[model samples]
Target: MKRLLLIGVLGLALGGCATPKYNYQAVSQNISKPAIGSVNEAYVGDKMLTQGVFMEREAYYVPEAKKKFLLNIPKGYYLKTGEDQKGSYYQPVNAIPDGAAFVGVQSVLITRDNSFCFVDVYFNKVCNFKNIGEKRKISVANDNSFQQTLIYSGKVGSKINVGYREFSSNLARPAFNNDVEYDLNESKTIGYKGALLEVIDANNQSITYKVLRNFNKVD
Candidate 1:
């Protein structure tokens, strides 16, 4: 009888250790507000540069050979990494940029049926679309000058527009424009890569984006 009792205690202890240290369901229920898009800024030395919107949700931050996996958790969801570990859970609160050596932003879009997270790091810039339905526009600026405008549409057979100009040099000139067609049944991310603007659709289990134009000429 004592042997059985010892075995039961050991089993109970192991089972308790197997459970995650953090409560994922409690964290998910604590998120009372909706997730919103944000821009993470990057700097070279002391000079500030505009690093685009968050694009890649999952990535490894390798700073001086040390690697750490950074995962974006949605507002209403929690992430559990391993078992028998303490504080290995992540819950979304605000924009937490990846890496200690880098300055950037992490943005995520959460709907009733889907969750999309992305990161904008270093010199790479990306634009985010969240709560897209019918027609909506997102504009970012410094001081009073207009910087970039992200237009979104959920209408079938409609087109999304992105209009902006350089704030430093071309402040008075007309903003350049790019347009991408929208599909109601698809979820996508549209942004700039190097010099080209593209739209990525992740609908059919495959992700793809089309280059629209070279926006680098204006830069």
Candidate 2:
């Protein structure tokens, strides 16, 4: 009798450890297409990674490696839709964007190695492209000053506030001319509201960010 009871307990424990699979049909069918003047948010924990808005053009808010990459969807391209264990997948329809192909779902991993904070991007649910791009340096200061700096103001519920100064730099691979530089002048406390968990950024020296609990609320 005791042996049977032990077996039953073991079975229950294993069942509890099993990974839960979401109903893809129900989830995908309900995904709303981006509306004009509306913002769609994606997150890593409490940090906001991408905040896409549909305006005159589809704008993507990609904050990676302490740098903000606000890219517009290329002309004649639409967002291809899919989802995975990681999160919702949005890739350019039919063709590659900016010469980079989206093989599959995308995810981000944060790692620390001695003096650098690595915001690693994973594609197709795998960490394959570790050295494919140039490593941009970001500086994290211990004190707040007049100079431009990357700052996470705070978070209220699902809204994450971030502040930064205006700056412009050349893309690692400039599409038009190698001599041309992209201007980035978003210097204000912006709030990323709804459907996000974390906001991550790094300095040239260290990582400075906040991570809320792991709550994947896909809406």
lDDT of 2 by residue, 1-219 (tens): 553353354331111111112232211111112222333343322222322111121212232322213212222222223333433333323122243332221322211211111111321122222222222222211112112122333444334344433222211112321111111133212222232222243222322333332112324
List TM-score per model, in order.
0.19, 0.17
What TM-score does structure 1 among the candidates reach? 0.19
Cand. 2 TM to true fold:
0.17
Runs with alpha carbons beyond 4 Å of true place in candidate 1 = 1-76, 79-88, 92-149, 152-210, 214-219
* Clashing residue pairs, backbone N/CA/C < 3 A, model 1: 52-125, 52-126, 53-126, 54-119, 54-120, 55-119, 56-119
**Model 2 deviation from native, Cα RMSD in Å:** 21.5
How far in Å is the alpha carbon of 209 misplaced in model 1? 11
Candidate 1: C-alpha RMSD to true structure equals 20.3
Choose the strongest candidate by lDDT.
1
| Candidate of highest TM-score | 1
Model 1 weakest lDDT span, ten residues long: 26-35
